[model samples]
Target: MMLRGALVPGMIALPALAAAFWAYAGEHAALSALAGAATVFVILVVGLLGITAVVLGPAATSMAGAGVVYLGQLILIVTVVLVLRGVDWLDGRAFALSAIAQTLLMQVGQVVGYVRARHEIHPGSLDRGAAS
Candidate 1:
């Protein structure tokens, strides 16, 4: 459910960014960007999936469950960074930049999803009717 909103922007961005990097840098940078973006997309989806249960559960448990899921997500990212650091072929700068871009795009998607969700739960039409 959450993955729908979170993944859209990243998927839309990947091809354009990869093509741009290919034009300016080379095959290596382009592949690096693709790899980085893919890695982030997988991680984000996993994180969102992990939180789905928490988000659907009792309100009181939501915050604590989210906290744990996020902590694990951070650790997973750090591990990926460390493991990738030893690679010789990957362009570090391109990889890092692509990851950052993907992360930002996902954040934007999350915000949009939140707003959409809020309206669905308590739309203005309902409020106006209540006020009548």
Candidate 2:
């Protein structure tokens, strides 16, 4: 639920983070940050698509599907880092820092989006988590 809406805040955070990286660091760092941050966003979107497929299936299959998606994403992310590490123009410090920050920001966005949205767990739906 929150994952769809979470992207907005995540997008907003990127520019701010990039500006900070540019100001405190330098042009190379800024470029590295932009690349790293954007890559994370793309990876997250792709993972979401993979998970969405899981959501529409049977309960028995859902857990395995979700696990596979998560594990696959982790492998993809590590592979990206390794490949990027070999690039002569890349800044490992900036890339890793930016990626970590972007990840945390996106997760925070998801939580905030979830809290702000109306959900079935509230009093309006059938399962209110109250004793009858």
lDDT of each: 0.84, 0.80
lDDT of candidate 1 at residue 117, scale 0 to 100:
66
lDDT of 2: 0.80
Q: Could you tell me every candidate's TM-score relative to the true structure?
A: 0.85, 0.84
User: Once model 1 is optimally superposed onto the true structure by TM-score, how far is the C-alpha of residue 39 displaced, in angstroms?
Assistant: 1.0
Distance (Å) between predicted and true CA of 9, model 2? 2.1
Model 1, 46-95: lDDT tens per residue?
88888987889999999999999999888888888889989997998888
Once fitted onto the true fold, the runs of candidate 1 whose alpha carbons sit more than 4 angstroms away are 120-132
Tens digit of per-residue lDDT, candidate 2, span 22-108: 898888888888878888887876887788789789989999999999899888889899888988877788888888888888778
The alpha-carbon deviation from the true structure for residue 17 of candidate 2, after best TM-score superposition, in angstroms, is 1.9
